[model samples]
Target chain A: MILDPDLPLIDRILAGEQNVFAELINRHKQYAYTIAVKILQNRPEAEEAAQDAFIKAYQNLAGFNRQARFSTWLYRIVFNTSISYKRKNNKVFQSIENTVIVYNHEGEVSLEKTDKTRYLNQAMMKLNEADRTALTLFYLDEFSLDEIADITGMQANTVKVRIHRARQRLADELKILLNHEALTL
Target chain B: MNRLSQAQEDILLEYLDGTLAAPAKIKLEEELRVNALLRLRLDELRAVHTIFQHASLAEPSRDFTARVMQKLDTAPSPTPSRWPIRNAIFLLIGVLTAIGAAALLIASGVFDGSTSISLNDSSLPQKIIQQEIPVFTFSGKLIINIIIMLNIVVGWILLDRAILRPYFQRRMQA
Candidate 1:
C-alpha cells in the first residue's frame, strides 16, 4: 500500500514494535524543537517541551489517525506543549543587551549579520507569543498555510493575516532597532 | 511622499509573495514604476524577508533525540483506561466508604435529636468572664447532614477529574 513513510512505522508500532518509535523521534525532532524554541523563546524550556511532546506522541500513537501527515500531527503536539510550558513559566523576555550571539572568526559581514540576527531576536520578543509563532512557522518555509493553521490552531485566513501583519511589524521593529544602534555608536 | 495605507502595504506584501493575480500584479507594477514611496516600502519588506531567509533552525542539544527515546521508554502509555481508571477506582472506594460511614452513624442513632454540641457548654468562657454567653447549639444530625452534603460535592468533583473527563477526552480524540 502507498503510505507515507511514517504510516508504516506507526503500523509497526501499533503491531507491538516499540523500538521502531525511536526512528520516528529522530526523523521529527529538529522541526519539533524549532517550533518549541519559536514559541517558548527559551532553549532549555523548549528542549524540555519538545522531549515531552515526543513522549506524548508516542503514548498517543494508537489514536493517531492517518488523515494528516505524521509531521503535522507531531508539530501540533510540539506547538501545544511549548505553549503550555510558556504559560506555566510565564517568563519575561530577556533583555536585548544581555543576549549573546557567537560567530566563528569570520569577517565584518559575519559580525554585522550576527548583530542583525540579535536585533531580530530582540524584535521577535516584542511580539506576543501567538504572533511570534505564526511568523516563525511562516518563515520556516516547511509547512503550508493549512499545515500552519493546524499546528497553531488558527484558521488559514487568520494565519495569512497574522503572517503579513507580523512581518510588517518586524520590519518596523528592525528599523527602530538599527536606528537606535546607529545613534548609540 | 505620503504614508502608505494599510491596504497599500498589504498589496505590496502580497506582490512580494507572488500571490497577487496577474491583473493586480500589473496594476502594482504600474504603481511601483511611478511611486517611489511604495517602492521604498517594498524594499523595507524585502529586507525583512532577507533577514528571515538568513534565519535557520536552532538545534536542540546533542542528546535531544536520545533523551526523547529514553523518556518514551520510561513514561507510561497515556491510555485513558490505565492510570485514570485506577484513580477512579480509588476515588470510588473513598466515596463508598464515606457514604457507608454516614449510613452507619445514622443507623446507630448517634445523630439522634438528644445528641448535640453547644458553644456555651465550654467552661473556659465562663471562667474568663463569669457571664452567660449566647448559646449556639447544633444537632449531630445537622452536622452529619452537612458533612454528607460536602462529601457528595467533593466526591462528584473527584469522580469528574478521575473518570468522566478522561473518558470523554479519549472519545473526542478517537
Candidate 2:
C-alpha cells in the first residue's frame, strides 16, 4: 500500500480530508495536461480543460472505482473532457506546413531541427485524435494494453489492435515526416 | 513492408512487451534465432517501441498545479446540496420575476422614452440629428480603429485555424 500513494490519499479524501486532493492533483496534473494539450493543441485551453477535469473528478470522487488505477480513470476523464471541449471550441483546421514528408530512409531528409521532440509533436498532429491518444498512452506512459483499454473504453484485445495499428500509422507518418528508414533515433 | 503479416506483428509486439504467453514466446524466440526477416521485423518494431518510449512527456505551465488548486478552491463544494428542490424553486422564481419585470418595463415604454434613465438625454437626440455623428473625439476614433484592427487580426487567425489552414492541409495531403 505504501507503494501506491493513491490508495491512502483516496481514503483520506473520502474520509473528509479534502486537502489531500492537492497531493493527487500534484501527482497527476502533468499527465492530465499532457493528454489535454495533445488533443486540444492549444496551451491555455488544455490547461483549463485539465483543471476542469480535476474538479470534475473531485466532485465525482465517489464514482471512482478503487480497483482501478487512479491515473487510468483520471486520464479517461481528461481525454473525454478535452475531446468534447475541443469539439465545442476548436473548429480549426490543421496545417501540415510544419511537416516534411519523407519516406523510410530513402535519402537525407531535412530533420535539421534541434529536437526530435518537436519533430515528433508535429508528426503527431497529423494523426487522428484516437490514434494520437492511443499512442500517447501506450508508448509515452507505458500503460498496459488492458489499462489503455479500460481508459479508452475499448476491450483489451481491441486496445492491442489499436496500439498496433497506431504504431504502424505513426511509423508511417514518422517515415514520411522524418524521412528516416527506421525510428532508430 | 516487411514479409510480416499483421497478426504476426501483433504477436511480435506482445512478445516484445513480454505480454505474450510462454508457448508463443518460446515459438517466437525459436523462430527469431534462424529467421533473418523476422529478426529484421523485430528490430523495426523494437525501434518504434524505443522511439515511443523516449518521446517526451509534456509538463504543464509552471503554475499548472497551483492554478488547478486555486480553481478547485473557488469551485462549489463537492457535497450534495441539502435542499436542491428549494434552491431550484427559488432560482426559477428569481428568473421569472426578472423576466416579468423586464416585460413590464418594456410594455410601459421604458426603453423608448418613459422609464428610460439618462443623465443627459436632452442633448443626445439634437446632437444625433444635426451633426456628422456624435460623441466620438479623435482619441476615441483612434482607439476604436485600433480595436477594430485587433479584432480583424484575431478573427483572421481564428479563421485560418478553423477553415483556411485545414482546407489547405487537406489539399496539400490530397
Candidate 3:
C-alpha cells in the first residue's frame, strides 16, 4: 500500500483526529496564502481567504478523491475562495494611476529596497486576475504547468500561454514604471 | 510580422537559462549564429526572467497560522442530531426485531400453555388426589421455551451490532 500523507491524514480525520487537520493547514498555508495574495492583492483579504479555504477543506475532507493530489484540491479551494472574496468585497478595477513605483538610489539602501518591493507589488496589482494568478502559481509558488492546469481547470497549453502572456505584460508594465521602453520585440 | 519561429524562440530562451540539453544547446547556438533578432529577444527575456526570479517572497502576517486555525475552530458545522433519516431507520429496525421475535415465539407454541382453574366437585379425598398432580408441569415444553428465549436474545444482540454500534462509533469518530 502507498503510504501517502494525504491518505493517512484523511484516515486520521475520519478517526476523530482534529489535529491532523491543523497539521495540514500549517503545512500548506504558505502556498495557499501566496496564491490568495497574488489574486486579492491585500494582506487581510488574502489571509481571510486562506483561512476560509482550509476550513472548507476540513469540512469537505471526506469528499476528497485520492485520484487528485491533496495540494491540487487545496489549490482549487483557495482559488475559488479568493475569487469569491474579491466578488463579495465589490472590488472593481480602477485605473492604475494610484499605484506607487519605487526606484533604487545611492543613499539609504534599505528604503530603496522597501520602495522597490512596493513598486513591484503595485505592478503586480496592475495585472488582470488570470495573469496575476498564473504568474504567482508558476513563479512564486513554483508550480509546474500541469499542476497549474489541475488547479485552474485549464489545459496545460493554456497555462503555458497564460504564463508567457502574463510575463510579457508584467515586463511591459515594469518598463512603463521605469520609463524605459527597452523591449526587444 | 518578421519573428523567430516559436520553437526556435522557446529553445533559445531555455538555452539562455542553461536549461537546454547539450544537443539542443548546440542546435540553438547554430540557429542563434544565423539570427540576430533571435539573440536580442533571448537576451531581453533572460534579463526579465532574472529580475522576476529575484523578487521577494511576500511574508504573510506574523500570526497567519494561528489565525487560520482559529477561523477553523470557529466555523459553524451542522449539528449531528439533525440526521432524522438515520434515527428513523434505527427505530424502525428495533421495532421490527421486537415484533419478529414475538411472532416466532407465538408460532412455536412457546406461549400456548393453558392457565385455567378446574373446580372439582368431588369429596375431600378426591380433591387431595387431584392436588397431587403438579400444577406447573415441565416436560419437552421447557426445552422449547428455553430455545425460543435464546433466539430472542440472539436477535437483540444482532440488532445491537448492526444498528446501534455503528451509530455510536460514528459519533465517537466525529
Chain A, model 1: TM = 0.85
lDDT of 3 by residue, B1-174 (tens): 466666765675567557789998887788779888777667656655766677656666778777766776676541223255456557556756766776677788877775534344335577367554434544444555566577666656656655676556445445
| DockQ versus reference, model 2 | 0.17
Model 2: residues >4 Å from true position, as ranges? A1-4, A14-16, A65-67, A93-110, A113-120, A140-142, A178-185, B1-3, B21-36, B80-174
What TM-scores does chain A show, candidate by candidate in order? 0.85, 0.78, 0.80
Any residue pairs clashing in model 2, and if so which? A92-B162, A102-A176, A104-A181, A105-A180, A105-A181
Higher TM-score: candidate 1 or 2? 1
CAPRI accuracy category, model 3: incorrect
lDDT of 1 by residue, B31-149 (tens): 99999989888988888888887778778898888777777777775443356568776987798699889979888988887543555666674557666666555678878888888
lDDT of 1 by residue, A39-103 (tens): 88778989999999998898898677556788989999998999888777663434321343222
Q: What's the TM for model 3?
A: 0.61
Sorting all predicted structures by TM-score, with the top scorer first, yields 1, 3, 2
Q: What share of the true interface contacts does each candidate keep?
A: 0.58, 0.48, 0.24
Question: DockQ for the candidate 1 complex?
Answer: 0.24
Which is the winner by DockQ between candidate 2 and candidate 3?
A: 2
Instruction: Supply DockQ values for each candidate.
Output: 0.24, 0.17, 0.12
